[model samples]
Target: MSEKPINDLSPVVIALALLIIGAEAVFQLANAGLVGGPRGVGWRMEGIGMFGYSPAVLERVLVQHDFSPDILWRFVTYPFINVEIVQAAFCAALTLALGKFTSEYFGGLKVLAIYFMTAIVGAVIYGLLVEGNAPLLGGFTPVYGLIGAYTYVLWLRLGQAGENQLRAFQLIGFLLALQLLFGLIFGGGQSWIAELSGFAAGLALAIPLAPGGWALLLHRLRERS
Candidate 1:
């Protein structure tokens, strides 16, 4: 098999990974008391309030029919901040790996589109579905979108090779199974709503993002109809 050049890794992927890791590092420094101000320890709560997505805030905006810039931007910003180091590290690792694969196969622009669109859609779903004051934070939702994109790529490859197309779904199945086990062991959170939404968004977007994807999708739809 031919090996791809190391330089083939998308700059967009590297940049996104750096941004997530960098933000997490700042948050960690703040949480460790090594950094002063909002980014330091003892202040992460405030930071979360400011950056994390709050359904209450979104609800207020909807109820009042007023959208403030700060609240409006939360949809895009929430994915950059995480609650813990381990969470951030896990998300960053996924962003780098899945982002690279998606970017290589679909191009950097599509990868970025899928990521941000998934994040927005996930946030919207969470806002509408989840109640209460628990705010949604972390990068996993968008990372799940990347996972969806990767799965789509795998699905395409499997189809072309006459392999079991369902096998491409194994990654998501495993993740969801782990999530189920974790939830059973230690109560479930609403964040899964957003994460799963992200994955669905990524998978749907793949139909349009893949090469000749739109045409293929339309043809299939026409045939089905």
Candidate 2:
């Protein structure tokens, strides 16, 4: 029997999962005084301050044309910082699941690129669209990108199998519904802008990032003409 696709995790996926989970682990341990020094209690907050994405910084650089490495790095670095362990755990689990299946088709480097590229797009859209004081942090935005890729893959598979391609969107649909419920209950913030944008960007990226994606795009274009 064939093994489940989730078992086919790639190096990039494993690395990404480890980075998110490991960072949270360190933060949790520090809070419990099991690791780091006496100052470890503040490690989580410090990490957020240092690594989290600040829209204020992005706006300042964009308006003033002063793009510094420190400010720019937040686009990618923010995904590594999570405010809580539960959030980190969910993000990491999604990364592993989606990354593994997507990697089976897109390869490890492409999978890595999807994560970074979607993250940047998400942050850019978030910065441009939302007006808030809180700096954005966490991997959900990029993991949502992976969800886009996973959905695209499922779409293609369903299409080839003569099944309902719309079914591919069920995962994202459920997730969005869950997010909506949480937002209604907990009063969520503008982070949804980043995540939703990431998913859209990821869906678009599937065209170029997938193997022979550009060629296929050109072929379709030629057919339409």
Candidate 3:
């Protein structure tokens, strides 16, 4: 029997799953009075938030409420706890698109591994650079990583001996311009830092993971056989 092909669930999907489920569980425990908030919000609460980039607040929460590192992990994880409906919806749409494409192009396991690795890099970068007391949350970091991978695939597809090369370069130019526009409008912050990390990670991973567009090369080889 032929081996079952990998599913198109991206690394972001897995991270989001963990974030959503963890949030639900925490909220449920809070509702049942089994667990209290890190900031002593008590049960029956709705505006609970995780410490995003505020390591100091996180440390205080852990010390004051006796919370563990697991709680910290939940707050920092992707698909961050955002009460804003619009923000959540926007992230969800981009997550689905980037995650699906990346997973389909690169194997699911590889995508997951790369995503986590990049997340670590992103978090570290943000922590070192960003100085603030507010919470940070969002999956834009990993989403940026997916964009990096997509760009690599595009470059490989276009950087060839055909019309595709011209098309790919055009697409790349457009994407770069878009990134610049968003950066200008949004201004520099933790989000931008995460995006930068994602881009760096994507480019790093692409060097080995993609390398002249293995996907296309494989297809050609199969056709020959």
In terms of lDDT, the best-performing candidate is 2
Candidate 1 lDDT over residue span 90-171, tens digit each: 8888888898888988999889899899998899899899978788898889989988989988977776676777999999
TM-score of each predicted structure versus truth: 0.89, 0.91, 0.60
User: Which structure among the candidates has the greatest TM-score?
Assistant: 2
For 13-101, candidate 2 gives per-residue lDDT tens digits of 99999999999999999999999889999999989887788678678779988778877888898998998988999999989988888
Q: lDDT, candidate 3, residue 158? A: 55
Clashes of 3: 2
Tell me the spans in candidate 3 whose CA falls farther than 4 Å from its real position. Answer: 1-51, 55-68, 71-78, 161-188, 211-225
- How well does model 3 score by local distance difference test? 0.59
Candidate 2 Cα misplacement greater than 4 A, ranges: 1-6, 217-225
Q: Model 1 lDDT vs. the true structure? A: 0.85
Candidate structures ordered by lDDT, highest first: 2, 1, 3
